[model samples]
Target: MKFKNHILVGVLLMVNVFVFAQYGKQKKADILFNKFSFVKAANEYRELIENNYNKDYATRRLADCYAYLRDPRNAARYYKKAVEQVNVPIEYYYSYAQALRGIKDYKNSRIWLERFKDSGGVINANDFEKDVNFITSVFNAKQQYFLDKVRFNSKFSDFGAFEQNGKIYFASSRDEGVSVKRLYGWNEQPFLDVYVADVGTKRNVDHTAKLKGDVNSIYHDGPVTITKDGNTMYFSRNNIDEHGLSKDKKGISNMKIYRATLRDSIWTDIEDLSINHSEYSTQHPALNKDDSKLYFSSDWPGGFGGSDIYVVDIKADGTLGVPTNLGNVVNTKKSEGFPFINNEGTLFFSSDGHPGLGLLDIFGTIQGENDEFVDVINLGIPINSNKDDFSFSMNPNGITGYFASNRTGGRGDDDIYAYHRVPTLQVEGIVSDAINTKPIANSIITLFNDKEEQIAYMVTDENGFYQINIDRNQDYKIVGSQIKYIDDYRTFTSKYLQTELTTITANLLLNPVQDVIKLAELNTIYFDYDKHNIRKDAALELDKIVSLMQNDYPDMVIRIESHTDSRGELSYNDKLSIDRANSTYEYLISKGINPSRITEHEGFGERRLTNGCEDGAKCEEKDHQLNRRTQFIVVKME
Candidate 1:
């Protein structure tokens, strides 16, 4: 069992040239597998396994075939058997772990990943382990896309959509009824060809035909990008010429990027880029906003992964510069390809290396402070699935685009989907007091759409934090309110959301009610010397409390505390303070203030004196008067 057989299994499906066994049947199946014909090769290997002819080799080849077919369930099943055999190669442990991930069996995936690491297999195991919660995070993320299957999708693979000058160019394996039919060995479908369609509106496919002239080849071709003027095109094709495919020393024909000129509505002047090499593949060309740079994916040497995205300078003379790999920020230890650059200079690509929903999810880049791409963010759900998703291209408007996926519920093995971005606008922040800056827990935050109708509302947590998702391109108003504070109003619109998900910080500062009992600056209510009755001046102060509770804060609940001067005995002072508290409570009740509004009315006696008027202390008359005072505490304000 060779380790090379387990790596680089698709696109440029490189396999070790060694014969699995000396038997004729094993040799035939090995040739089929090497030709990227996993469908036929799987059948052959399955038959050999049934007959018990070199069962070990047949079983291993069968697992590799299913893995190429993107059937992870069957792949995991066979890989389990292969790894359980004697003298199992180290690659099977890693491959089996990946297969388990494809089926979302993360617990078992981690087990195999640890085994692979323990066996000294330096692969994506470390990264895979760190992404243990990746699936959960992807599913829980805000939905960023609404997808629909394009009408032009066929029973075969239809994908790679690029928009140019009101026309849509894509790659498809649909049989076009050509008298001489050619089929790709990979899935028995017709060889992929570039097709053009007059798409007047988004996702509308009418008037379709093959691209004119030398662009479409008998071998795989297309998934093309055109210049702004639509006169120049760049596309991917097999590394072949007029004679035959140019094979490397290992007998493998890799992919290459070609440039063509459109003359008189016919494409011609096809020239292979100088950067292409026979040993590796460079495909999926995407130009920047100004066309000064071209980005593509390749499995060229010195890359960080099986395939990595690279860029080259496009000179005025229509030639290319030296290729530079996008560093670890964009490229990982696993395969990444299908680069697309939007007008905003944001790079989008597909990757199995990054944490995503499952195998090969689309990811976007976040730039650092130095204007270099740093963080890679998964595009998340709908746009990604538990299967291969790639070839993401956006239209000039930047809101609508197309990508390909082999996930379930598609029209074919690989279907092209037209997606309109549903801009995710998240309003989040803390609701705090304007004066104290303390979190106003249990504050109500309400969201209203453009029509002024309340869409949703939520209560802030103990930390006074809240978050809400709003629709794109719509005006919204978020209001925060608490019982004791005035409403905080904020209005914004999502019409200019630049990213797939835009987060707006709407930290609210609520103003506390000026005369609320909690913060009210009132003169202390005093009493005559050692008297248990409310004084005339004290009645005036108590009336203020009554008016605030009755007219302004009708739902105010309060607690009253009264104290006595320290000149009297402790027991006598305690009784006098109690009488004063009752008198004040009765006064508020006589003014029609609700009795239940006073949750607690108790005398603290001389314990909580406002002045230094303790017993046996020398104090002025005013000092003792300050000690014999009643204070109001606002308990709840609705």
Candidate 2:
């Protein structure tokens, strides 16, 4: 079927599958490789390598074989070798990073991903900042999910689950004898068919059987979304006509949505929905509360690109209204599909374009006041993986859900995993000016979990109040940032222990940036005669300046200027004064200030004196002391 995973993993199963070229003898491996039989491909490649047939080429192919086979350990080992070999493809480096992530070696994965990026040529998305931040926050935020591969999964691919009438219905590609004995050229898996089984236990599914109707065709029959009442259904199927299957201009068959009605335990009156297009594919249908709106993924004309989530009104007569693209916030130039709308109206979908760990990562977005998907949030890990993760479903209960993934440890190619949200502990507070206690509104407050990874970010309201949900019994860091003010950061733990700060009231303080820019008085450094070492009093004074620059005035630069009385040789005074300036500059460097921000420290020697106590000029000791002092110049500010 025409597919685009353009949206996610599901469509990739059919569309854009790469075919390996035929190599002369033992075309054996190429056949299996093209069939998506990674396991067999790896074995054959290993044999070829053992026979000493172009080890470098075989090794790279072998690594790719293992990568598709989902054996990350072996994939990582061989990919490491492949990346170092000559003529390695840019994609090989990305595959190496993905393999590393599959093995939970994320730090190393980051290293290889950087290498892949540095190797140039756009291997990953540019929008990775939010994804990186989200992954960091999940580093130690106690695993909230207890995942178990569903028992009903076939040895082949099985996913896209939904519940109705105490029976679980899902899509699978098990080669049941009754179906047509044809293998899909893309994956060599049997054509997908919808199956139903009695509601099984959490770990095991009861006996299963294919749906009895005109649903399963000789061609691709995939995911189905049914209404709450279970009478109406929208499913994906290869575009077929009375003359048989139809092909688009690309010589590829397209996918279309077929609606059916269930009557007396049998699905009947099947008909194509109006949202389909002959030029593009539309699949993965979903619905809102009253089923008045039908949502699905499509690559029809006028889309941003790939597939985008589109909603159409389900008219009273069961016809589709005009489809509206969810827009750039939810859809990107890349694929975004497999939409699941929860009861709360929040749209959950998977996309490769959004900031993500890798591949297709799940993102959540709700319609804002303007009725648009705004501020999409990556669902984080366990729900997401470096591999393709799509086809998410959350029950109306608001806690339990199911999602599909081909990550490291699945029972099948794409298994459905169950998830339940754990209770969350929340932190709420107000931010204000430290000195006057005035509310600091609209400040950005970031919360980092125990692992020092940011877990949540909030903007203070007009009242300076903010709240964020967090995991219980874990340590956290709250950092507040606002323009023209210092970052207000605090570290606190969320716990119920007697000694813990359970009744937290983090009314943060943000010192005005302008307050620190006036540094002349506070920036003075005094040195004993002929001594360039920083003194205790001077060291204490520098601490305040360092803190402000590091916390608030990040773009500010300072210069340390030293002057001296003309009591000694001109050259001696210049050298001594420069030494004093160097001593002060080094002090700030040791305190974590960037050397670039220090600009340059210079000494004018006796050329410019604060007092006339120079050469033969008579002056009191205080006059000489004034010229011995060091002063700071605000070289730049932002």
Candidate 3:
């Protein structure tokens, strides 16, 4: 028994030593990270984690180190592990969510954000609001619904995928005939091509067509994106033509972005992006959803790394402006490439130099203030394996993702694969008059999500239709109303898994009231003198009155009254006021109001005066104008 006790003591001592060693390593890593020696810090933290000592703290630190090193995949892996093992602190959840966002997994990121919120985590709502990528992700989910898949395999190399119109575009070198190629001074096949397939049905490519371009010849053509209208195409091209090759005479083996015009559904007249230069290698061009900005990967001088992502504004005339570095938060000393910008403006890129799982893995971040990137996160595995898993693409909805890997098993050196993504929900509907089966144009619709947050509000179109997309697994309340009608309220619940068009139709009925009510609330009623023409201001006032009547007192009717000052004969003034009131009534009718509900004009020729100032009795021009105004009143409040 004494011997056993001694053995136990020895084991405890060894454990203590291990723990101390881990603690010492962590301290050193923290110091390194504090000093901005993120690479060194990541190494130390990785060592500690590998030794399985102080794993939770070590993993957390490791993740932080990786983030500082600009390696989000490894960072995310450790963060996920840390969260799973213990009650993850709010900070950890925030970090994890950020990592998920880095890879454009906004749905999961949102889930984590909610978790963070539930754990009493403090977040600046404004920060989230300005996060374009996050906002885009939210918008995508609310706009459409679909099941997503993350395809994996051990074969041909696959990289990034982009969706435009009803087609999927991606980059791959799987069909390379040569056994070896070279990229960025690395030995690899020189063959990379941009391929497209139909994305309307299941995630299947009917035929993989290579992008047509001389610049795409015998080099890498990848990381492609097209404009929203599919009129212009932008992509990365490595190793320029012999005429523009580098000084070394090796075909100027650096990458640059090229543009092409899509005419009659075919790409024509390929042109180099005006922003490209021979001195710096630029690749992986991605355009914002609005095509207002271009983001790309480069190793140009004045950058932070072997390759860093850069952005430039696309001017209205299709000219490119000076490129701006994405800043140190996203760029590191190591290479960062293969950037993909979702419709929401979240940035996804791949890096080897950052603290990551192995060589190269996908990472995510968002553009922050001063054009800096914040919340750098690593995508965790299966998405990121031990091997290099670079090149990522996502749909506009932010649920599904596609990336390239050389893991194993494929038709060639690399093969493209599709992935399943999370689902999102949106709400859309129409508003109309209860009496008429016609579309209600410009009916106000307000949507409040389950979080009791007013997500959006919009007016119906000429057809009285409105739409508000929201996240799944949430309850929503919609309030619809228009002028002269009672407000309509409806409720709905949506889940990601559900596939159905959710619609809300609200019909409002108005009750008949009196003719010629006072227009006390209106600011002005602009009109043409002596012409009885209602101006823009007059139209606006009529719209407001219509909205209140429709939404607040749907069952109530109203009357339009026109008044004239004593500047003219009583007969002339009465006729003018009557014409003006009728004109106002006609404008309302044109705006989709029920004509039957509106009573005829009640022209008062200088008979009523609130200021008691007669037109010829020292009345100011303002008073005369006020007396000549048009008024609307509820004839019936039902």
In angstroms, give how far residue 85 of model 3 lies from its true place. 24
**Best by the lDDT measure:** 1
Put the candidates in TM-score order, highest first. Answer: 1, 2, 3
Reference-based lDDT, residue 332, model 1: 94
Ranking 1 against 2 by TM-score, winner? 1
Q: TM-score of every model?
A: 0.49, 0.47, 0.44
**What tens digits encode model 3's per-residue C-alpha lDDT throughout 304-412?**
8798888899999989899888778778898898887765566788888766677887776644323355556566555566777777777654556577666554444
How close to the true structure is residue 228 of candidate 1, measured as C-alpha lDDT? Answer: 84
Q: Which regions of candidate 2 fall more than 4 Å away from where they truly are?
A: 1-144, 177-180, 201-208, 425-638
Higher lDDT: candidate 2 or 3? 2
Worst ten in a row by lDDT for model 3: 135-144
Stretches of candidate 3 exceeding 4 Å from the true structure: 1-155, 174-190, 200-208, 212-215, 242-252, 367-371, 408-412, 423-638
User: Stretches of candidate 1 above 4 Å error?
Assistant: 1-140, 200-208, 425-638
Q: Which candidate achieves the best TM-score against the true structure?
A: 1
Each prediction's RMSD to truth: 22.9, 23.2, 23.1
Candidate 2 per-residue lDDT, tens place, 1-638, comes to 01211233333233212111112222456445433344566777887677544355568778866654445788789989988875566667777777777777878877877887888835436423223332222222345455654677767777788766777778888866553467778998887888777666454442248787878787877688889888888899989888777989997788998988888888878898777877789899888878899989998878897889999998898777888888787889999999988766778899999878779988866343344543466777789989988898877755667888888888779887877655334476667766334466779999888788877876775546665656567888999999868798889876653322223556688876754436654567777777788889898888988987888778777767887777789999999888887788788889998776665677778788865677999888777777886788765556
